[model samples]
Target: MTSLVAGALLAAPGVAVAADAGAPPQPLVGDLSTWGSPCAAGEGRPFVRAVPNLTARLYGAGDHQPGEASRVSGEFEAWWLDGDGSEERLTFATGMRSDSTPFSWQLPAEIPADTVISWRVRAVDGEVASPWSTEGEGAPCEFVLDRTAPGKPVVTSADYPDNNNWTDGAGVYGTFHVDSPTDDVVSYVYDFQGGPLLRATPSGPEGSADLRYLPPAGGVFMLHVQAQDRAGNLSSPTYYTFRVASGRAPAAHWSLADAAGSRTAAATAGAAARAGIGASFGSPAPSGTALTSTATLDGTGHGFLTPDASVVGAGKTFAAGGWVRPSAVDSVRTIASQDGFGAPEFALGLRQEDGGPVWSFAVNGTRMTGGLPEAGEWAHVLGAYDAETGRARLYVNGRAVGEEEAVTPVAAEGNFQIGRSHGASGYRDRWKGEIGDVRVHDRVVAPAEITRLGSRAAQLRGHWALENAPEGISAEAGGGEPLKLAAGASIFRAGDECDLLDPDCIPGDWPLADEGHLSLDGTAGYAATDKPVVDTDDSFTVSATVRLADNEPAHPMTALSQGGVHGDAFKVRYTPATQSWELVMSHADAPGAAETVVARVEWPDGGQGGGHRLAVVYDDATDRVRLFVDGHADAGGTAEFHDAWESDGGLQVGRGRTADGWGEYLRGAVDQVRVFSGVVPDQDIAGLM
Candidate 1:
């Protein structure tokens, strides 16, 4: 890397000399370079991988005359500093003008793992050779060559075990130990889920680092770590998988919102229930998000039952119920219940003798019944128990109805039942009505919060209004299946962000502030769903608010996309050159398939602005894709797309995947993302905005 002037023979590695009266001015060798070095060395030696393509620079020099130019030949010499003065030389001509040019040679092989290299250059003709090049101080120029990769690092956590079982709680922090000290590792690079690689420096020569990280939400997550040596060499990554139990999350929730179903679907990851022949799903529900699920049961002993174990223990505090609308109040009709060997463990529904149905919140045989709910009218009913006070309360439409009973409910540990109950006589009292948003909270609910459970919940709580930390990724309007974290995106406060779903389970450290937006570095970070958000072949809508770090980038950048076999099935990206927002749809999942870019709307700022509400809808019915900006249809952003294929990859926020890995990262903030199963109406999209 070192360079020297030919006129100054006082010091340094590059050879230089002053023109004498007689001979051609000694050719000057300024500096040396290796193909492996990413950057040039200006003042000191450079480090390069071994067996590099080495080159030396020689200045034009006079051959026949000491002060004039003439054709000349040059010799580049290199020697290993550690080896006995053995030298290697290569020869080249400077052509007609004896012009300055680079002379290259293959660096010596068969060298030790760590070696120091030095080189010099000179011009020669006939019987005369130019003085050897050297630094002004007569010091040799040298560079270190290192080719060995660092050893793999070991990742260990004392608090959370390997992916054996779910950790005790969500958001629990674990300090992971990383090191391969003896291998000359200087730092560690790690990331969560597939986020971004963050560097952690070692405390000392041990090359050991302890990284403290916490899971923002529940479900399975992984941490990747690798050792980085001083020479910028990285070892293969060590993957650490961990699980955080959804202890505070609902044990099970049936939205009953399926379009048509004999088998009911659930929002939560586990806790699926089976619908009986007489039970049907996808019925009209009280005004709510389209995600709301409603189920109807024909009174002929029909209902839904989950094949899950009892989630609520006898002595534990819990809340269970849903939205209900009954047909007749004749017999004891149960909306939801858990079985008991003899009588029913508990049931919440409508029951009255001679007149209108009365809302009932019954646990065992003790019923907290009152409040007349007109037949065929929708009502929110809940049965909540607090073990600490040994009290049970029934709520109708956010208000406690009937007297609060201090009853000790027996353990109704059995399959969760819906629309029917196992009374002493037999499996009777099948519900002849509609039930929606059935949920079971395995923890005690404070009376003040019970009121916020139904139609009374906040406007922006997504499907269920569940609270999540900045690190945790919730379903938004998508429902209970929270998205998994990738490389870990952090949260930042955007003036309009909302975080009203402050559930009891959220950790204390999470501040109850404005809604936080996702901050991505346009790298390997994004939020991912466990399964594909939508069947791309079907009509669907994807929307979110985005603010990019820069509106005009050198390349196209994606705000959201889903992966296919070789590329993305669909991409909501900003094309820098066109200054337009485009929705690209792929024809197939394989590589080099025909692609259709239907929507193209140039931003008002001519690619100078980045904040906006963006949405893309693919209506399979018309085979057209529509783009919306700030909830309004974009005339310039509409066109037809063909041969739409279904993508099986999970929904990815802030990035698009290529054949090799993730790319097109959105470098900015994204908030309030929502993916709907079907095309959302124009007015509805605006209303959501």
Candidate 2:
């Protein structure tokens, strides 16, 4: 007798020793079963469906069995059908397993979402092998993995008391509530002060939590919260930050961080400086800070504080500025108006009197006009008066736009009002839209000082105007970094030209309206950022206003791109052949490349030329890309582009890099090019227009 047969008979708990007459032992049979997979029912049971991320435990019981609990030694084999009509064998252990069942195996990893997996298992003992057990109600297992991530947590309320000075309190407490997208949220992680992340417990009500922390001596506190689902998927975090009187105290400052609330003075600036809140306060404007809010006004009412002779003395030089967003191109929206009608003191506002919206500064009736800003956009308006030179200057976006000389200055008597004009016509010329970071200085401020304030407040990474030419190196407005233009690029001043199709079609101000555009020669002309403006796979937005020159070409004209290789990174290209604009995102490995066509739109049949403002946003949380044309969602937009981008070269404008050399040069005028480090909301994109 064979040694296998002898051992089988001796070790068997209840089995009649039988020989196959030198032939293969009688085929073994038992029950084939699966566990752990939700779709699996019982022994020899068929599976209905399983999730792709799940691991199915397949096991089989031997027929000539030892005791029910005894370990059964055997070899197991399994196979499943692939999507392409091919059979793939599964790897199995040769030794019997002793967990749950005598023999068990886990299905392969990532079995494709929503795929029908038909698998069979058989057991073998030496030369004896059992026929594949029939699946009860035999059918292939189907599964669909839950690949979607939960929505971001909504920060409903974040409130913290203003801890003004060193005396009021050392620590401030804040309460915030985050509404989870689903009920499956296991917990929330609160990242405070960038220290060890803390898991928040359910506090007041269901979705709220309390946060209290002491500031780092003179520093402030910052809190960010993220939610985690039961499946271990984490939602994007939201942040809130509040200062604790760290910097120098201003003579008079209104942070305007109140949302539908009363305004207050900085504790360090003294309590007498609080400005009276206006009734026409609308909603909150973007403050750039997490916790603080900027007040919005509906062009009515006004906030006023008792005049501080030291800061607003008509005889003393003074500088005033704040962030403003106008709702429309209406006449005279005041920022600061002191001393009512009757040839008052000083009044700062955006006036359309000089044919269009201009930042106007008036002191003792002598007025100066600055560059006009588009409606529905934020602008930094600053005006400074030199008591000695008798000169009052207006600066818009940090550049001196207009200036005027005056005789000896005269001090006026009245309260300093914000957002409304103090005219004999009662409350006239109420400033519309939002205002924030309003400050007043007793001393005259230089041009360089105003630029520094604007730059610091904007917190921008790259702001390229492309106005400088011939070796076109323009200073970035947000930071005075030099942006080098190469390959025969030239400046295209809007000049005496006007594009009627463009909404900013005012013929007189067309030059300033479109400003200066960088023209590329459709060859190897482009501009590059000094540093990497955007990072690979980061949440960032690239926006530019592009006007195609009158020429039909065969190749694509790249307006802007990163990642030197044409086939491997983000590219905004316009193909003249098809009159189509496309945003392509691609990924590559040593093996090959894969691409996600983020968006592609053809110019409506006959529509061509003129300026089209295009924006592409990469939303980090969703791993998706969105395309906007003319301030709206493009025909092809909001698509998935999860490929990792290569950060090999500096961000380029007007051309794409390839193996040969620079190519896909854009033969057009590109202006107002901006790169931001986060997803630009739709409404903001619309305002870009």
Candidate 3:
């Protein structure tokens, strides 16, 4: 394992963070935990779990002497007040120094479940003891301890059988019954699709939960269930196994191409998922499709909700895909997902990893990346659970980007969602983008069908209207073409603008948009795409907002580089020895020297890599590479270097590769890392910063 050696580094100076002057007061006993985590591991009902040492506080303000408040004589005691106007003293924690704000106690283990009683505190100083703190403190605050676990729950399914016969097919909505062994059981814990455990609250007084589960595809499935009582105690788990024959039409569908703000949601083929209170509609979608609009979720708590979770559950084959346009890529955002009350079954979304925004399909929260998409650009994305192969697959623009042998997926038991997921903290990971034409299938869609879905959506190339291009993908944007970023958002351009109105717009020159970037770990970490950014023999431009994890590094590092044979054709790196940012080009594939251009400006005043924009431009005709700092070329002649050469290697972020293997890892973070095919004008490059 790589050590977090950077943890020993000091935080860089120059960044200001406001201190939180106001925060909640900590409990007197810092280790006193009230959450019911241990209950899950406790013995089933009728058996109580052991309680650990607990603590309490007594106010002795009235007992303290005026001048000597730090210490006092006598003892302090605590009591539990019953509802019947009677009190039973809590048997412990009796220290009597005025300085002792909270007294502690080691109560007997195995407190009876459903025990609820009020509490009081008293202190005595020598012979003059203070009155109990029950009068003015209003009704005594309740102290309830429940260590008993609930009885094991009973789980049954009617739609699929575990007899090993492949009968039921995919996309079938099935019902599950979770019955508690005890009446007080309030909820049930269940596992689906080898993902996280989920919760289903009992809607009836008899302690039962009726759940609707959708088999997304074909596979052998095992469902695990457990009961939870009101005291937050859990019972032993119950398990069930079932199987479904693969290949069937989807039972539910959601095409998010509804009108703007249309709360009356509808599905083109299956059950409809209702729009939320903050529903936004009629956003732009991809071209070349019958649909022209999409639903935009703002990433707060807004999304479409399907009351019944007729999606896929544990061990079921499933496939979901859609067109998405994100508004931001700096954080986690879910476009399509479903889950129960506790853990998530799956989510198709965006996350920042490896120093860039990537498209990932998660199975039980384990993300498999598809590719990278620029914010404000359009892309088709999909996730699949291949039961036959026992694998998880992800695709971007119809091309497989990532695949892995499947881990057990936890099944979802609550609801199907568009643009968000549910957890203990309510809805989270909401999508801050436009998502539509989402289809969930019972079987893993074949590659040809996946490709067909994307091709018909739109064929627009290169830059798009903020549809968000995934990073590190051999993605469809640029249609494998090349160009330069012209604005803050991605606008793929050659020189200035492509105007169809001028009747001179070239098919290959149509305007495409992208202002996305990639990230890198300064360690031995790096990212590579399938194609090179551009031929180094030709003019090209690249820029990124960069920040280093370590303010001061032990050695030099590269933010970006491309290779062909023995050496990098070009590299953008920070040389610690020179304390400068340099752009390098190799003179030969062998052990030859390189032509270098350095930025002459002092490092930005902000500490570490405080998001400084660095741009490298190579004008092949001029045989020179120009370096710009924060959008402007430093006045020093060192900013430009002659004798540039072409490196045909694919674009790599975070590290460079040499004849010696990969080295020069970037220890910092970078954003808005854009690569264009042609050199943009000085004014255009300046506008990016």
Please tell me which predicted candidate would have the highest lDDT against the true structure: 1
Q: What's the TM-score of each model vs. the native?
A: 0.35, 0.35, 0.35
Model 3's lDDT to the true fold? Answer: 0.60
Model 2 TM-score is 0.35
Superposed by TM-score, candidate 2 places the C-alpha of residue 244 at a distance from the truth, in angstroms, of 27
Model 1 lDDT vs. the true structure? Answer: 0.66
- Candidate 1 similarity to native, TM-score: 0.35
Per-residue CA lDDT of model 3 for 126-238, tens digit only, reads: 33334333333323333456676878877766676557677665555667888977877877888777768788889866778887665555778778888887666788888
Which one wins by lDDT: 1 or 2?
A: 1
- Error in Å for residue 520 of model 1: 51
Off by over 4 Å in 1: 1-30, 36-47, 62-73, 81-100, 124-130, 158-163, 168-175, 197-205, 210-216, 247-286, 289-689
Clashing pairs in 2: none
What lDDT does candidate 3 reach at residue 499?
55
Per residue, candidate 1 scores C-alpha lDDT tens digits across 515-543 of 45566676766766766867777567888
lDDT of 2 by residue, 1-689 (tens): 11121111122233223333422123223233434443342243333233322222222234333433423343333344457655544434446553235444555554543333443444433443433332234433333333344566666433433333232112222355666756656578887678888887545455545554434233566678787754456777777655544323455776666445555433224233444555333345543333245666666454443344334775876778877777866777788777634644787888886476778888877888867565665667887776756777888766787556674575775667677656665656777777777787655555655765553222246777766654468667776445688866777665446676788776532221245767777776788876577765556788888876645655778888877444536878887766777787777522235666655564622224457888888864346788888887754677876565546667888887545556888876777888876666677886654
For candidate 3, report its TM-score: 0.35
